[model samples]
Structure formats: structure tokens, C-alpha cells
Target: MVLETITRRRMIGISAAAAGMALLPLYGRAALEAVTWQGEAMGAQASLVIHHPDRAKAQGLVAATVAEVRRLERIFSLYREDSDLTRLNRQGFLVAPPKELVDILQQSRKVWALTGGAFDPTVQPLWEAYSRHFSTPGASETGPSAKIVGERLGRVGLDRLVCSPERIELPVRGAALTLNGIAQGYVTDRVVELLKAGGIERSMVDMGESRAIGSAPGGRPWRVGISDPLHAETVLKVLEVEDRAVATSSPYGFRFDSEGKFSHIIDPRSGATPQRHASVTVAAGQATIADAFSTAFNLMDTATVATVIGNSEGLEAYLLSHEGKWRHIPARTPVLVSKAL
Candidate 1:
């Protein structure tokens, strides 16, 4: 299974994944200006590209979008010392938590149930152990010992928290939360909402993942290139997206090992899923689900991938094996397609 590069381990030290985009100009039309913005948020590069008829209005909208993204960082970023997530980790409880935090936690619980615990936010402890173990000046090439991992694994599971509208509590001492796996996509969704609220439709939000708000200038689907996990500089497939989100997760994106064999995506159950895929890409209407499921799908086998995709209403996956072979759960995913050579 392909795993997300934004495992909780990423919050400790690993850099989050950065995505790429492509937009073509439409000939024989009015000036379909595409404005762009670039900056860093949640410890990685963020970009916004939009096509609009009114340049001034769209620029203002983009500015508002950047501010919105920064606001979300305060809610979800683990790097910030005062983020709600950081405060919860430090104090083990947060009373009167922000609504956004509560919303995300509720969604995480649903994903946890859907993926059979594979998409767990409580994997923070295990991620800490592995990330810290390998952060030493000259650490061992292996993962944390079975004993160390097992102790931390005891702390794994979202059920450790008592979540409610009044407050959320982590009863277990030292228990923490990590939304890295889904936060970026959540932020992208919010940005899309913000843009749409301002009358901007033809837009692309790339905050670690790509979300297409609407069709391109000429009513064509937005084209997104899926990078080769082992060699990110290359694009293995191009997906056409319209009012959908595209997310990719891989074992080789961020590795503690020099050979790029180990990614930080630890299976909260088994402690690890063998590196079996280059990456798994998911397309869905909600960026959060697309992000969370892509991470969890990396830990699943082919049969489970098929079952999960089939049962879900409008979700699809594109799997690229470690050996460079391509596979799809339904033999054909409706929202994503490979670009013909």
C-alpha cells in the first residue's frame, strides 16, 4: 500500500511533500489571466493559481486565501508552539477546543472506522519514537526496536480521547494528536471554499496536495501530474480533475534510510507496512477524505484497496507499484486517467 508522506513523523523533522501543477492557455478567447501566489505554510510551500475575468478582484481573493491558509496553520500545524494541537500535546487536554479542531477530530474518527484503524491520528507516539530514533547524529539504519515500538504502540488509537463539543481530553498522559496526514488537504478545501465564496471558480489550490475547484478556462478538466515516488522529478501519470481533489501518498517520499526504502508511514496496527508501492493517488469530492484515504490505503493490500474503493460512493485509486507497474482497483478509475504518450 502507498502511504502519505505527511505521517506524524513529518511534524518532528521530515519535510512535507510538495506538489506540481500545469495550466494551458486558451487561444481565441478574452484574456484569461491566471494569477499566482507562493509562500510557506505548515512548514512547506503553498501556492494558489486562479483564472478570472476581473484581475483586481481575483488578486484580492488570493490575498484573502493566503491569510486563510495561515489561519488554518494555527489550527493544525505541529511545528508551532502554540497551535491547538501543540497545546493538547503539551497539556494532554484542551477545554473548549476550537470548532475546526473538533470538526477534524470527528472526521478522523470516521476515517479510523472506515479504514479499520489504518488511518489513525493516535499514531503520534509511534511516530515520535521512530523519528527521534533516527534523528541522532549517527543513528542506526533500522527502525526503533520492537520493545520501544511496542510500548509506544500501546498509546496508539483515537479512542484514547474523550471528544465532545464542550471539550476534548486525552486521558492518557503524554498522548498527542497529529493531523498532518489530512490537514493540508483540509486547508486546501477551506481555501477552495474561500475562493468560491468570493465568486472565483476556475482555481487550483496546492497546499501539499492539489484540488480543482472547477474546470479550466476553456471548460477542460484541470490536469495534474502524478510524480514518480522513487524519482519525484518525473511524472508517471497525468490526471484530469474537475471539481475534485487529487492526493498522492508514497513510501519513498520521506525516508530515514539512505536507500529510500523506509517512509514514515507506520501502520498503527503492525507498526509498518512493507514498502510495496511507488504511490497511491486518490480522487474525491472532499479533499480531506481523499487525503486521509490515500494515507490509509498505503497500508492496505490489493484486495482491501479494491474493497474500499468499491464500497465508497465516489472514490477511486491509482496504484503505482515499487516495480513501476500500474494498477487500479476497479480496473478503471473514472476521475483519473493516464496521459497517452
Candidate 2:
């Protein structure tokens, strides 16, 4: 089955997947306009919503956004089989990749190191192993299979991945990479840079949940509704953010029960679902860091998450535990609250 999850927190009214059309009202007069266009990317349905007042400016922003998406698709998409990432997977190493891909890989390695290996692209092999084993009868219910999978996951280490400025090589044959944790955020950062360069100041572009930028019109921060942890249709809180990126990592979005046991949000470190936190939302100055840290924090224990957020300079976080309480770190003191609150 195609696993689906909402990994970010941004409010663009939901539209039917067919034809990629959203039903939200488009602002026409306020020197700000919003439009949603859907296309296939990263092996899934991708949407782009650009909001700006100048029609010409908005069009340019959309063009730049599309170009950024296409560029990332070429570098990170595993579905293409011919993508740079896919080629590396098939060949065990790639020589002389595009500069953009090289840059992202280098950045990913840095994040991997910073997170103490909690966030890793090399966990693709572990995901495949768990998915295959979980699909078999009795395997999901048995602890033995899970133990076996976890043991095998020990081999999926970031240290096994070697990257130079010109090339990347995986030491193990089965090691694969998935940019799902950071690619969208990187794309979002690029789109924001393009919009700024094009002189369009206020806009929001969402690539799934990992990237969103800009604010609404009239000098107001873009208002986003966070989905209820218990119910996807309900809003638990509203956040007003501007010129920043927000990402939500939650197991509630995509989960499945096998023989009365629940599993979702696979921990790359353990090849199993993490049991500590129910959901985490991170807002950072950059989308790539925000996206990567959300997953990294999710895999971390409560104390580590607290330590990371407490010491982080520009990162603000909202976390919900499995016990149904909300906690925040590095309190902004007088926090901004939405009307719904």
C-alpha cells in the first residue's frame, strides 16, 4: 500500500487529488493573490501555492517555484530510476553530480552528524526491510521479526555513506537514500530566495509539510491551523508565522495496525516506531533545518529534545505527548495566539 502522511503544518484548503485543484478563495485586489497548482513530483502528488499582489510578480514566482521543483526532482526523486539519486543507488557510487545535489548531500551529512545519526538518508534499506517483514502474516505480531529487523538496521549508518565534492559512494550494496526528510525544505528555501530576488515579498509556498514561506497580505503573518493530534479534520491550534518555515512530524497522520499492534513513523535508528512523543512542530529560520530537525527530534528521547530546543538559538517548538498535553520549550514569553485559541 502507498503510505501517506502529512508531515508539515500549513493551511491551504484541501482540494481533491484529481487534477490537483484547490477550492480555496483566491484574493484578487489586495496587491496579493493566491493560486494553487498541482503536478507530479517526488513520486507523489505535489502542490504549489503562490501568494502575491502583483499578477506579473506572482507569475514569475510560480515559474521560479516550478523550476525549483523540477530541479529537486531531477536530483532526489527515486521514482525516475534515472534520477541522480537513483543512479547512485543502482551503481553504488556517482561521480561528478550536479553542484546542487552535491551541496544537499553535504548539508545532509552535516545534519546527520549534528543529530547524532538520528536523521539519516541511509535508512532506506531498513525501511524496505521493515515494510517487507511487516507485510507478512505473523511477522508483525511477533517480536522476533522486529528484533531481527532492528539488528539488521544497525548496519544502516551515515558513516557508511561517503561523499566528496564531486562524488558519493555507499559502502554497502543495499544502502539507499531518501531525501524525504530534507528535500522539500531545501526546495522551499530555494523558492523563497527566488521570490525575494524577484521582488515578491509576501507569499506562502508549501511542498507537502516540510516547507512554507512568507506571510499573508497587509503585513500580517500567514495564519496556519495545526491539525488536531487526535483528529485530522479538527484544528488544535493556529500559528501566525512570517518569513519562517514550519514542519510537523507526527505518527498520527499515517499509521497502520497489524494484529492489534500499531506502527508508524519508522525510526531510522531502530527500524521501529518511536513511542515517546505523539507529535512535534518546529519552526526555524530555514526550512531545511526545520524539516530535518523535526524528524531528528521525533526520534530522540524527551530529554534530548528538550536539550536541543532549549539551547537552540532560532528554533521554537511545540510538542504534544501521547498523554494528551502540550509542552513548549524556549518560551517566547508573550507568545502570539490565534483568535481560535
Candidate 3:
């Protein structure tokens, strides 16, 4: 599953309006000023905005953060044939793998176990099957058959993966791993940490996943508009984020069918896209947790989603079910934006 970008990255580094749900860099100029940089990372466009009084200082920090992002992508990106992940998939194992690679694989294991395999990274074979099938001439909008999905499922178990600081291996040769579901959030976290370590307090990093290190310009809370799936241009709610991470997963973000029916987030357990929720937005102290859970929530029932979101600390979810019901975990009612006029 390629981590299709949730929204298009604008050429301009900043946005003045918060009218749309594309997570605009809507930090107005007030008591504070911001410096931003837009670049490509992890097969998608990435942007960074930092509030700083000194322009030169912020430029230096932005340069370092982008460099750090490129460094991490060498370890995680699957598009690069020379990347560690690609080498592992080609050779079936990687010896003396980088600790960062091992760390994320371990983290993915925890999420896989926590969500009862709803967040498996081992679903790449199934993705390949669907991509291959759907690209055929005169293909059906419907997905592949049960038999084809079943064959791919044999290589879809996270338990079949062996991950350690020194080595990572896939037990099945046909099994490949895609970090699309969670890597963006991890990259966001790392970039934010790099910025924070440099004594930069106010910032927002959107590396597919979004995280804010401090309040927006003028100390106002960062407002994230959650897009209504039913009405693509509508805002469902506004989540005020301060020093927190936010991620949204929508099946419609990437479609395999002509009519946009099948989603890219295929359930490893079912070998089909589950439509329990139209979209899931998770907010947490850590982007990694928010990233993984948002993907998992798309495959979960409402009750199961509530139970998990309620028990998890530092986590909040705004979910819209396929039936057009809004659900918020932990009973914390956020500000729901009125429909577009």
C-alpha cells in the first residue's frame, strides 16, 4: 500500500485560510512570524513551518530538518531500490540493519498486536495483487477474487516476520513489507524532534502525517480541520492541537476502482477493504501512535474503536462511520464545524 498523500502539497509554503481541510499552514502573522520550507520526502511532498524571530536561524534549522528527513528516508522508503527496506525485501533479510529500521519494525509489531493485526505492515503482497489486477485492460471495478487474495494472505502475517536490531527477515519469500500506514507519522516525529532539539519551540511538520510542536502564530491553538468524507469540500470538525500530533485516514484518499469504491487500506485479515468508517483522525502526543491507530481504526467496528481510543492515554479520535455517523472517543466533544455555507 503506497502511502498516498492525504492532501496535495501547495507550491507556496504557507496558507492564509483555514477554510478547507487540507491542513493549511494557517498561521496568521500577528505577535509571531513563521518561516517555512516545502520539499519532497518519502515519495510525497513535505512542508515545515517554524515560528522564529530570526529569519537566518530558522533557515538553518529548516535545512537541517530536511537533511535529517532525507537520512531517515534512506532507511524506510521502499521506492528507493538502494534503501534498506528494499534490500531486505529482495534478499529476504537484512544483516546489521540500522537501529532506526529495527526500532520502527518493533513499533509496528506492537501496533499489529494491539489492533489484533488490523495494522499489519505485511499486507504488501495483497496490495501488489490488487494493483496488478486493477491495472489490467478492461478490469472490473470490483477487487480480485477470494482465491487470489487468499494466496497473498499466506504472506500477510506479521508473526512471520523476524525483527531485531541486528537483523530483519521475512519468513515467506513472497511476503513484502510496506510502511505506508505508519512511516509518515514516524518521519514527522523525527523531524519535530530534530527541530525541538535545536531549541525551536514553535513549529508544524506535515510529512504526510501532521504534528505541531507548539501553538500557532500568536499563541493560538493550531486548528486542524477534519474533512467530511461525504462532502469532500466540507469540514466536519475543527481539532485544536497544541504540541500534539494529528493524522487522518480516509479510504477515498486512494482508490483502485473507476467509481472509487475500493480503498487502498485493504484489511489483511479480510483481504478486502473494510468500510466501517469513512475516515479516522487520531490525535496523540506522539505521531507514530496516531499514525498507526488511524489506519487501524479504518478496519475496526465502532465499539472496538471506542474501546481502544477510550483506554489509550494521550490519544483522541474523531471518526465518521460509513453510515454518516460521527463518533468521538473518550467523550471529549471537540468543536464541530458547521457545514460549508
Candidate 4:
């Protein structure tokens, strides 16, 4: 996914806010450090940030964070054609996958069930088709027709995937898996666990929006401004979150065509890009679940999305449409204000 650039005004405002907050005595000891690392992981722009009381500790934390991301990337990335997942997709069943891969696959199955197929890693073929077609112009430009996309979607049933403590198998060949939806969040959780184990109290990490964790130092929650989907220049809302995770998914992130007709987020049920809502942000106890559910809710209809959010305990969601209208459901209602009001 393409990372949206933060505008000049937003950067200036954030700098001013940071400068003003830094004047406080408590903020004096906090060490804020950010690092950008390039690897063949997560397709593009995998990053990590750490805030702590000492530069040495922050450096160690960042090192551990990078190591963790690289470790997970080795297991989950599809960029490497020789990766375990690629082999599995080619060979149908993989015997004795590494312990980490097994655990992630099992957890992914749970999310698949919870979202009622809205979150499916088996959609990798669809992603592959679109990404390859769009990235390279005139590369056999055979778009998956409605029938073929439907067939692939039908094959995306979570029940088709089987796993045991010792082995994992895909019932069909060419059934690829992409952890783009959940792996980053898992990495974030791991890094947080690492920092906490090291006795670091507060921090913030944004792994391309899927994985954002912890709080700023000084006993205060991290302040995050939700970007306006249409304008990109303004923030729709500001959120105060401590010890929680937030994720946003939208068609605004990527489009396959210049006319902005084809989006990367394809609705599995319909085999089409979702046009119901421009974007959806979900806040939950775990960043991984929040990340998956945010993308799931974006593909769902209004009633389905509402039911999912309402039934979910301690989950908050915000939906923005193309017409500049917004809807706040459940826990987000208190923090979000309608511009119309």
C-alpha cells in the first residue's frame, strides 16, 4: 500500500504541538526516536518508532523492533518468490511449517471466522492479479472477469484451510496467503511486548497504519489525528488513545486506474471494490484485530457493519463517505463530531 504524505501545514502544526508540549518539565526526560528501514517486507515502507527515557534504551528497543519485523517478514511476505507461503501455494500442503507460521495461521483462521469471511488471506490471488496488472501496463491485461473472480472468491472459504500443531495445508493448489492484513499488527504487539519486558513504559510505533501501539511518554496517551480522506490536508478528528490500538482502511490508500475506478481493497463476496464508505477506522484492545476488522467493516454493508460493531465489545468504528459525511458508531461516537453539526 502507498503511504500518504503528511502535508506541510500538518507537519508544522505537529511540530508546534510537540514544541509546546516539550516545555513541560515531565516531557524533558522523554527520548523520542523514529527509524525507517527498507526490506522486502510488507511490500513497501515498513517503519518503527520508539519513545523512552534514555537514548541507549531507545536504540536497543529499535534494534529489537527491526529484528522482530524482519523475523515476521521472513515468514509472511509474498515478495520473495521462494518464501514458505509461495511454496505452500504451489504444493498444496506444507508439512511442518515453522512454529511462528503455524501460530499466525491458526490465529488468522479465528479472525476469518469472526469476520464471517470478510478477512481472508486466501485472496492473495486476487491481489496478485490486480497488482501485477496495474504495476505493469499492458502485461497481458486480462482482468479477472466477474465469473472468474467469483470462482476465486468462492474458493476463499476459511474452512478449506486446515492446520494442526505439526502441519498446515491448503486444500487447493494456487491458494496463496497474504498476511498484509494482520502481520504488521502482530509485529507491533511483539515489539510492545519487547519494550515492556525491558521496563520501558511508553512509546508509539506506526508500521504502515496496520501496527500502531503504546502511548507517548509522561503518562499521557498518544494523540493521533485521523486524516480526511477527501482533502488529505485536514484531519477529520483527533483521538487520545492509551494502551489501545487503532487502524484505518480505505480505498483512498490505493487505486488501480488513473480514473480512480479500481481500488485495491476488493470485496470478496461481490468481487468488486467497495463503494459504500470511503474509509473505516476501528479501535480495539489489540491492534491486529482492529486492523483486520477495519478492513472487514469497510467491505461490509451498513447494516452488517453496524451489527458487527454493535456485537463487538469494547470496539469503536468511524465511517467516512465520499460526500464528506461521517458516521460514528459505538465507542467512537463520543470522540467524533459531525462537521454538519
Candidate 5:
């Protein structure tokens, strides 16, 4: 679904989804001040916005959130040399794996099935092959040869991965996992949990992905802007969301070549670069679902994506075409409302 070659594709900026928050109503008698914190997590910029009357308490919450993010990064970060993921990829097996690692893998497996293998984490080798090819001088614009892709495909499959309470194993040699597509959302959700546990009812957690703990200040819905793939600076659409998570995936987010053909989002089933949409934005109750489905929906057709959304409650998508047209799943809904800019 999504690849995280730290040098090639880290936490993609394009998929960070929200442009900025709308103007907030000033705090009245509540005396709530919006406390903000910005930092880095899992190789991407991260931030938190909390509205609290007590700034000191909010700062403490921010500290706890940062600590939690660093803890998870030690497990999911591909850039961290000593991360559990790095050790597993280097050795092909992990003994007594962390419960968090196993839990995310299990969540990945569920989305892998829900999207019919579109949300795969075993596409790391494909990323390596393409990154190597593009790094060479005068590489072909057409991408890696079919033979090379086929060979890499042979080692890519979630079914080949074994997971249990005690250990996690990759049966196929060279098989690896990249949680770039899902881990950020997992982290965002976790931050929201921490903030909620700290008595924060209205806040926005942007830990690579974004999740609103509740409505914005003064009962207004949070506004999330979706940037145009052709023009990253242009916010093509805006979504009014409350107590929901939004994630976007764009083929133009990261390209191996200057022509913008090959992308960081790879179709694991065929080892092919996505050519379906300029971008696919998914909104769900959980940031994890929004993030994974945003990446997976790029590999699926409109009908298939629509069906998946139809079958699931509190799930919707907005697909932006290269032609600059927008397509919405379910056609109408109250969970998420969007206005084209």
C-alpha cells in the first residue's frame, strides 16, 4: 500500500490531509487557551492542538503524548537503526516481539483482507528495487523491468508472514513489512487516547496522521482541507469533520523520477505504480482505517471502493481525478460534508 524508504518515502507530506484549522471562536468565560506542540515522529512532522483553560496541564499532556510517540517510533520507524522493525527486517524473524508490533501487524492483516490484499505491508522489496533503479544515473523512466518486479512479487505476501504472542516470523526470505501507511494513523489514534485520558475533550492530534478528539472550540466542526495533487499549495476541497479521522494518498506525493510516474504507493498484488486517481481521501471513525484505506483505495476501482464503503458504516472517500474532478463515495452523507474550493 505505502512504502517507507526513509531516504525515498518517509511520512508523505501530501497525505497529511488537513491544510489548517479554521478560525476558532474566542474563549469566553471558559478561559480556554489553545495549547499547541510541534515535533517529529516516525520521520514526519507531528503536532498537537489542545484547548484547555489550564495551560500547564495542557503542556503536561503534550509531553506525555510526545513520549508515547517516541515509544511507538522505536517500534515502527524505518529510519531508526535500532527499531524493532529494522531488526526484524535484517534477520527475517523477531523473537518475543513487542505486543504493539504484533497488534499493528494484526490490524494490517485485517485491512489487507478487507481491501483484498490492496493494503499490504510486504511491498518493501518493491520499494527497494525502484529506489535503487532511480538512484542510478540515467535510469529508465518506465520503471523496473517486469522480470524484476515479478521476482520481488514472489517474496511479497501477507500470508507468508507468521505472527503469534511469542514471536513473529517472515517465512519467505527477503520479505519485509512497512507500516508507513498505517502506523502514523495508529500513532495519531494513540495520541488522541492519551489526550482523552488526560481529560481533553476538544483537540486535534496530528502525529503524521490527523484525528479530532471531538468538535473544535465552541461546538463547530473541524475543517480539513484536501490539497490538489497537481498543485500542492492549492486546497481543492474542505471537509467538515467532528470526532473523525481523515487521511489522503496521492500518486504525485513522491515520485522516483522527475516525470511523476512511479509513486510511493505501490500495488502489492501486481507490484505496479498507481494510475487510478490523482488522490484518494478516506474518512473513518479511526485514524488507522482512514490511513490504510486511503492508501488501499488508490489501487482499487471506483465500483470496488464504493462497495467497500457501502458495506462499512461511518466510512467514506473522496477521489480526485487527474482531470481535477472529485468523486464522492455514497454520493451523500451527514458523517462528512465537503465543499470544493
Candidate 6:
């Protein structure tokens, strides 16, 4: 799927008032207007907010950052006709692939193994099947038949993918890869590095995923609201984060049917939609980790999620059930649960 088609699937929003309050104390100034740049990145609405005493310098930084984002998009965007990912998918193999592409493919393999195939990039074939099935006129409410799903499933496996510094290949003829699940987080982290290098001490970077650099200007944590997927107007909970990243995933973000049955998130193992929760939110030191786990956690149950979180350090999560209940990992991460007023 093209990144442009994903804008409607985003479910996280920054708390503007809270972010403003926390940023006011920067540079010991009584008040400071944040220099912000708002635009789209990897198909999702994105923004970069910076608190600095020099307006000119901040503006220059924002300009440079925007260029960085576009550059990375060319490497990761699936819909970009000339993107590295598209070439690999069409040719079934890429010789001397970009280092960044190799890096992410390898990272995807690690997450695939960690989640036990719950987060597979090779599921692009299945995604295509469902998209084609639902887009046709008078399509069946039952979705694609088992025979088609099984055929697609046969082509889904990270083991079938070959990646190295010298080459990357999709050995199976019909096999393809989509980095939509993790590319956003990967790009977010790369942008964070650029901002840090530009001398940004306190900022919030939302490039598909949200990551905070340092606490808000006054040392108070940045507040981010986790939206209720089923009820867009509701805030399931607000998070106080400092030097961390947060990502949320829900099948409701993009449903194939008008009745809310089939969703974009498919379980690689069963070719079934997620039926456990309304949404899953994860926080970690890196946006990449939070984003991938949030997507994978939706495919798991409470016990399985707990086991995964327990083994990963500096990781926490909040799960909102279909019944409107909230649960968090480790039981020590303070959360303010509330609805939009």
C-alpha cells in the first residue's frame, strides 16, 4: 500500500496545551513561542517543535529537518515509484542495496523472530489479497476464501528473505515485503538523530511515531494523549514522557469492511484479523521498538504480551480492551486515565 493512503490510519495526537506549558520555561525565558514545522512524513501527519532563543537558527534547523525527512522517504516509502523498497519488490532481488534499507530489513528479521512470526514483513501478499477482495463491487462479507488465504500464507515467512550488505532478495516468486509496520518508527529515530545533531535539546518529533527529546523545556515531562480508536473523540489516557517514544496500534484504524469486520492488521500465522483489544500502546527508549511492539501486541493475548514486555528493558505498554478497560505493564508507570472533555 502507498504511504499516502495511510494518513487515515494514524491514532496518536500530541497534547498541544500541555506541550506548550512545558516548553515555556526554556532558556529561562518567561515565555517562548515554539518554532514548529507541520507536514506529512511516510504518509502520516508529522510535526517538529523546537524551543530555542534564536528564531532564525530554529527556522534554519526546521528547513534542514524537512529535507532529511524527504530523503529518508525515498528510501522507505513503498508507494514511491523509485523507492528502494519498490525496486526490490518488483525485481525480487536488489544488488548492493542502500545501507539503511539493509539495516531495517535486518531489524525486521529480529522483531519477526522475537514475536514468533506475529510481525512479518512478508505478509504484503496477504494485504494485497484482502485489499483487492474488498475493493471489488458487491464483495462477499466473509472475505477471501480459505484457499486464497492459504496460498498467500505459503509465501509469508522472514526465513525466505535474504539480506546482506551486498544483496537483498525475496526468493519466492510471489513474495514481497512492506515496511509499513516499522518504517515510520525507523524514520522517526533517524530524524531524532538529525535534530540532536542540530543542537535541539527539548523537542517533540512526530514522524508517524512520537518521540520526545529530553523533558519539556522546564524539565516537566511532555504529555501525549493515547486516542480511543473506536471513539476518536476520546482520550483513553495521557502519558508523561521524557526522553522516550510512544506508539499505538488498533485494527479499527483501518477496516476493510463498512461493518468493521476485516482490518489492515492481519495475523501472519492464521490470516485472521485481531479480535483481542480496541488498541495497544507501547513506550520505549526508541520509537522503533515502541512502534513494532504496539503492532505485534495487538495480535497477542495478555500472557503473551506480558512475557514479551518482561524480557525487554525500558519498555512499558497500555492496552485498552474492547470493553473499555485500561491496563499497563510493570504497574509502576504512572498514567492519567481520562476522556476528552
* Prediction RMSDs, each to the true structure: 6.7, 6.4, 6.2, 6.2, 6.4, 5.9
Residue clash pairs of candidate 3: none
Residue pairs clashing in model 1 are 1-298, 2-298
TM per prediction: 0.85, 0.81, 0.84, 0.78, 0.87, 0.86
Give the local distance difference test score of model 4. 0.62
**Higher-TM-score candidate of 2 and 3:** 3
Q: lDDT-based ranking, best first? A: 5, 6, 3, 1, 2, 4
For model 5, state the Cα shift of residue 110 in Å.
0.9
Task: Give lDDT for model 6.
Answer: 0.75
Best by lDDT: 5
lDDT of 4 by residue, 1-341 (tens): 11112221122101101211231112123224422233333455443334444556656766776677677777777676677776777777778887777877777777677678888777777776666666775644445566667667765655788877667887565676777777766765666677677655544445544222334445455656678776666777765676666677788778776667777787665667756788887777777777788878878877787777666667777788888777877652343211211
What tens-digit string does per-residue lDDT give for candidate 6 at 1-341? 10101121353222122223335322222335456656676666655555555667667677777787788888888899999989989999999999999998888887788788888888899999999999999989999999999999998898778899999999689889898888888887887887777666666667778887776555556666777797766665777777787788998889988988899999988899966888888888888888888889899998888887777667778888998888777523333321111
Q: Is candidate 4 or candidate 6 better by TM-score?
A: 6
Clashing pairs in 5: none
Off by over 4 Å in 2: 1-57, 137-140, 143-147, 210-214, 256-264, 331-341
Clashing residue pair totals per candidate (backbone < 3 A): 2, 5, 0, 0, 0, 0
lDDT tens readout by residue for model 2, 178-297 = 887788778777766776676554455566543333434444556556677667777676667666677777766555554423444567776766656788777777778878887777
Superposed by TM-score, candidate 1 places the C-alpha of residue 193 at a distance from the truth, in angstroms, of 0.7
lDDT of 3 by residue, 1-341 (tens): 11112231221122221211122233333224446666676676555555455656666777887787888889888889888888888888999999988888888988888788999999999999989989999876677888898999999899889988778899797899999888888988887777777666655567777776666556566666677765656776777777777788889788788777788999999898877788998888778988999999999987888877666666677788767778777433432221111
CA lDDT, every model vs. true structure = 0.71, 0.64, 0.73, 0.62, 0.75, 0.75
Q: Tell me which of candidates 2 and 6 scores higher on TM-score.
A: 6
Better of 2 and 4 by TM-score: 2
Q: What ranges in model 5 sit over 4 Å off?
A: 1-36, 47-49, 54-56, 331-341
Evaluated at residue 320, the lDDT of candidate 4 is: 84
Model 2 TM-score, 2 decimals: 0.81
Q: What TM-score would you give candidate 4 relative to the actual structure?
A: 0.78
